[model samples]
Target: MEGAPPAKKMKTERQFDFSKCARRKVALMFAYLGWDYDGLVVQADSDNTIEEYIFHALEKTKLIESREACGWTRCGRTDKGVSAFRQVASLIVRSNLKEGPGVFWPEGTNAANWKETTQEIDFCQALNGVLPKEVRVLAWSVVPEDFSARFNCTQRVYKYFFARGQLNVDAMIAGSRLLIGEHDFRNFCRIDKNKARLETSYVRTIVNVTLEPSKWSCDTASGSSAYDMLELTVVGSSFLWHQIRCIVAVLLAIGSGRESPEVISQLLDINTHPRRPQYGMASETPLCLFDCSYDGVNLEWTWQPRALNATIVHLQKIWVDLQTKANMVRRMLGDLEELPGASGDSNGMTDYLYCGPPAKNYIPLLQRPTCDGLEDKREKRNAKQNGAPQTLLTESL
Candidate 1:
């Protein structure tokens, strides 16, 4: 202890003075591998959210003075273990330009020659420098002050990936086609009684739904396409909670011949089936928020070459790492299958995507137990909030 050298002091980095810089409302295009994050939203109970990391990076880089003052808005909120390729958010951030669209200069600044100014701050590079590698800011554009990332979004596209393990692609396609127009999707979503009113509309417009071969190829060393990847692409104006996962669950049932494609239409018929039948939603790991489109907003994304190159490199590293692990697992599986008297037929669908344990005697969807209808759920929630006697409501029922 006596011979130990004096402990080194941690250097304190100086904070940036945001008051000296101009501020502008900018829209950021970003992506995240959300497997490790709690979710995209910041929660009071957890600090491991994607948005938490993002706001931390923004503040650390002095992109904004504070999260509260930044007026941040996100395009969509992704659940835990879900990923996004082209998620967008708009926020007011510090800027270098003295005069430009959405730019707010500090009081008493010289209003002279703005065209001769230096280029704006490279937001992608700045944020990526401090943010986790899983999350990357791809590009940014100056937007009008009133522009909203959520409200102005014209369309949201989601993609769910799955293996072709004994699934009837044609049947799944037919079922998905039934979801491509406006309909009451109450039966296909988890209702949040705390937030939704009894009279809240369950209607949503789906622009398109298509199933296609995945761009990512599968390993074919065994000369079997059973494990070939496929993608279910859904484009819509908006979605309800757990809607995509529920839809995929029903499609999985139809693809496996457990239910007919007409089951979709039956679920959509709220007049006949007012309550949602109890069914497990599909796994969330393979779901992705593929893209968000803003038709009315004029957003010209500016990508810095260095930032773009860094992002590509980072993504390549992730791909190589995951692919290597996957290949190793596949090799192990093949070796196990070659053993003496090994049954080569395993339930691949259950192995890849979880939709609940297999029922020994599968019950039809219409014959299953159902959840409380909207009005009943609302009454229960209201009773709880109003501190009314639960027994009285039960007696009335």
Candidate 2:
């Protein structure tokens, strides 16, 4: 006994049980930094996604028994490195609500009893406390049992920000205005049957699209003094894969004067130019899922003043570090600009990145290179299935 190791005291983790608590179908609003996430959905390969982290916090807080049992429905499946400000999801969660002398109320009882809860769970604080700083549970709502976050969502708003880079903001604004109203956006979006079985319709309504200067535009030092960050906000009933990015890419091309503003009209007329021309998409880092609108859901938020302050402080630290690095780059760029024969007016200020080629290289839209359009795709598929000759890209064009 004397030589034996001291009697080990077994350690226990704090456990919160929800077996008897009233459960309700609730929708939670989330905001996250997408730069580090592999998107909002949970996948087999990585637990680093926003959904994975959120579910982890939910489990730790004893809010749900399992992800499968929660009836999870995400509003959108944003691609990797895409951020969300008001992303929403519906799921069954443990509630502090009480009912008429029932601990585990009848299993088939009405799911709308979430309102009976005496006090709403302080989800923002509880989940934010456990989740990584990049992901935050902003608010939660008591939604209808029939609610489906994906199906019920009415509209989605997106914002993209970029420097002007000698861009024609007025022309960009004009180009965006052409996107208003319902149109078959097939030319604006690539055909992807996997993302949507309804690609045959290829139609979406754009409620509004506007370009405006960001708040920091008044700050002269912002963005190398050429232009501050300008944002393009688009509201739509729904969007296809890379749709917004593709639209933004075209707008940028027009802004750079490589393409005429009338090109938007030409692109919108699917009857004329059935295929999309070759072009690059805009960067993803500046695109954000600004909000998703639903008709009935009204989220009630609980603030964590103390925790929020700490978060603000952390953000300031990050901003400061980034500002330092940015200043160094700015100084280095200034030094390079002053180098002999490196006049700031290099190449007579010809465009570099956004444009495709020299002004002469810009051929008429009718003759420009084209990708497979609807008809061409159908031909290829039929050919592939029927052992017929596949349509060539040149023939399709």
Candidate 3:
């Protein structure tokens, strides 16, 4: 055995030469179940991000040379545990067409006989083949090279789904109506000191907000109809980080009779409440980026029938698995409620939907401890950037 020659290693598949292919700018519409992901964006400390997986698929499929060289932009950045149905992103990538509008052919390529109606690469299929089942590339559209997914988006829609367990839906709806129109939302968002200055405007326009019954039905046999799902849809031009979650938290508080509908108006009055009250946001698991609208872009997304059907089938399977588990839990709850001393009340269920544990004693919103003002946060950030001592900065604050 020691004298035998070393066995030859099998040949690896040759990597595609992207330099020889034509390139074009494209917008991709994709969806993902984000519960298991770190977040939508790639981070330095973790590889479990939606964008990281997306770029990996692109590279594996030879669709893009590299993420750095690709002119990448996303319409929205969802937080950890959030999901998306119609999230969009744009980038320049290798194309199959040798000559066409927005296409860049390799040098010295003869394009005299190139047809204007030549077919392009099946981007959705290509990416989906390599991407995980939780993520799906729905469709792709060839766009102008100048198009930017983030900047060109005209509107964004978010949906938060929750159980209607003893919640006052009417009061919640009243509070949501107050959120319509432009308002300073500093009190309802987590300010990122690194990206925002003290003078940064938090004014954002909310076109509409609505509450409706979700399509997903509860198991009637398990007596779970009382916990029917409800959907809160928020439409806006843009939003600050954690704005939707914060708003939901407040609305849920109102629904639970802990705050009045007037609290919304009070928060919107920046002069009255400049600093945000220290309160937990709603859970991110129920939040979703529903849609991103680009009004005049004329993005005619192309979809392959086979790929579309495959995506549908995969999603159906996931729904069946989740729904079955939910039903089992509901049945257990129903059985527990049948106990002799059990009370059927579920008034406290909403408390569990909040990100942090509920306080033992409820404090009114205005009376609660408030976060530092934007100016103070900016000053502290600047001091830290200048390498000031932590103790000195704390004393200064």
Candidate 4:
């Protein structure tokens, strides 16, 4: 038996026969509230990303066996805890549409008209059913075989939120105007200072940036009477990592008179220090992707409002209701009479000292107050006081 040549081992791996399938490219609109997730980009051995849930749904619905097999590509890599109203991804998959050959549906009852109905709105609903409550598919569209979400994108719009509290709205708006063109934003971004970073361009163009004030009101019957929530909306086509947050940090400093308005001009001038002051970035929870745009040739997708809009409204209502309850708890805590000699427990006392309603947030409002008198004097002093030139370029000498 040993001398006899061993029979060839039978192959155990299952070979998936995709050769008979006619592949078609499709683009899908993905929307998710990112507060509970890590971000949009997927990582190995990680389940806390919007992309992971998406691929899970895709596999659950038999869209693809794996992301790699589908040749999946995403338009943007949003940061941690950031939500998107509309983001895009493209992938290739076998098609059952009547327009393509080798059409096949999952094994079941055979319906000749199935291919015709695959491209309808019902497809969105069908996919959404498999997706989690936080993630939803807005629509799917058939695209040209060569279409790509990343390369074909003309612009990506990101919206950052800045809650208002004594914020110098005028100065922030003025500073935003200076950012409306192409410039090396290395100082504003958190780029990896390593040699391995290649091919990816960090110098993105800012087609436009707008800082507009927005208002929010909480329902009184829901145990809230505070109607004084103000915010700033900043829209930009493309942004570097933490770029928007860095800019907002400096502007908030300027608005509150912690820094001078002229600092903006100085930051813009690369001939000077060529670096910027270190400041904390804005909260990721407040950032949202409003929309993403691309050339018509790249895709032919229509916005399906019935489902997405309804979901958005429903979620917003839930959020508002929660906030109202929080406000109510805060008010009750504020009204509580402290027990005499409550041993260093200022607890409810601090809330009452702040007046009106109590707040659960230590820094709910981050904006700085405008200082007109001190700012005017500082401006005059700076103009009148002439000092030696300050330039890091010549500092070595």
- Reference-based lDDT, each prediction: 0.87, 0.74, 0.88, 0.61
lDDT of 2 at 287: 80
Alpha-carbon deviation at 301 in model 1, angstroms:
0.8
Each prediction's TM-score versus the true structure: 0.91, 0.82, 0.92, 0.68
By TM-score: ranked, best first: 3, 1, 2, 4
Q: Name the better of 1 and 3 by TM-score.
A: 3
Score candidate 1 by lDDT.
Answer: 0.87
- Superposition TM-score, candidate 3 onto the true structure: 0.92
In the predicted model 4, the residue pairs found to clash are none
| Residue range 100-154, candidate 3, lDDT tens digits | 7778865654455354547788888889999999999999888998899999999
Tens-place lDDT digits, model 1, residues 1-397: 8999999999999876555677899999999999888989999999999999999999888888889978899999898889999999999998878877888875644435233567888899999999999999999998998999999999999999888878889999999999988999999998875654466789999999999889877758787667678999999989988899899989988988899999999999999998888888889999999999999879999989999999999999999999899789888988887899987764765546765566678788999878887766777777788998653322210
RMSD per model, one decimal: 3.3, 4.7, 3.0, 11.9
How big is the positional error of residue 87 in model 2, measured in Å on the Cα after superposition?
Answer: 1.5
Per-residue lDDT for 1-397 in model 4, tens only? 8799879998896654444334567788878888788889897767888888888877666656677778788877887888887788888765545454223343432444343545533446556777777787777777776778887777887776544444566787777677767776655665443323222455656777676544454334424223233344544456777776667666665655456666666666655534444344556676777678876664556556677675676578868887889778756644552446444232332222222453343331223221222223333344445663432221100
Q: Point out where model 1 deviates above 4 Å.
A: 1-15, 106-117, 197-199, 384-397
86 in model 3: Cα distance from truth in Å? 0.1
- Which portions of model 2 miss their true places by more than 4 Å? 1-17, 100-119, 193-200, 217-219, 222-224, 301-311, 334-342, 345-366, 378-397
